[model samples]
Target: MARKEFQHYEAVSAAVPGDGAYSAAIAVKGLGAGGAPTFHRVLQDQTFKTALAADQAAVQELERLIDVTSEGELMFAQD
Candidate 1:
């Protein structure tokens, strides 16, 4: 049987000094094995004008990283 897993993401604006453009901080939380949730920084200080845009970019990045195709197929990466 396949083990069940859960993931959650959050994006927030992180503006830096002298940089006119806005950046985003993306955080991910994973749950598995009925254990404590694990936290990770997927993306940090990524360029985005707004929180909504940053969120969209973060999702796209995650999809690409996980090899999710445009046709909605999920592919696992080979080691």
Candidate 2:
């Protein structure tokens, strides 16, 4: 997993098991009191042949993230 910290939250890259492959995902966690953690499934239309590839893609996606909502939602820089 790859982790990135923002002003009020943190983003993590993850690889999830898919059909004969791996899928990229992002997990966002809010910082400070009353914060929550949210898992966001990314790259739904793509699958990687290896977990490492998926994780790497996820890390790239995490880097693209601009911010996190108070509700633990993710805001990406682009679609």
Candidate 3:
């Protein structure tokens, strides 16, 4: 059995609504039928109180989806 190849994408957070909150976006990349790379949005407008907080939350979510620890360090999941 061959392991499927996967791409890693960084979660981005941007300011929105002119408030302290931020909107998060994650890109999904895949190989098209023509064997060309394609990119699309998997998530958008995920609100968070602050940009840094949003980015940290995004990283944790990504780690959960990818089943990998953040830099081999332990992170507790929030309730």
The candidate scoring highest on lDDT is 2
Q: Cα deviation in Å at residue 68, candidate 3?
A: 15
Each model's TM-score? 0.37, 0.79, 0.37
Angstrom error of the Cα, residue 28, model 1: value is: 2.3
lDDT against the true structure, per candidate, is 0.37, 0.84, 0.37
lDDT for position 65 in model 3: 46
Shift in Å, residue 72, candidate 3: 27
lDDT of 2 by residue, 1-27 (tens): 888888888788988886799889997
Flag regions of model 1 displaced more than 4 Å: 1-21, 32-46, 67-79
How many clashes in each candidate? 0, 0, 0
Task: Give the CA lDDT, 0 to 100, for residue 11 in model 3.
Answer: 27
Off by over 4 Å in 3: 1-20, 31-46, 67-79
The residue pairs found clashing in candidate 1 are: none
**What lDDT score goes with residue 75 in model 2?**
84
CA shift at 47, candidate 3, in angstroms? 2.9
Evaluated against the true structure, the overall lDDT of model 1 is 0.37
| RMSD versus native structure for model 2 | 2.6
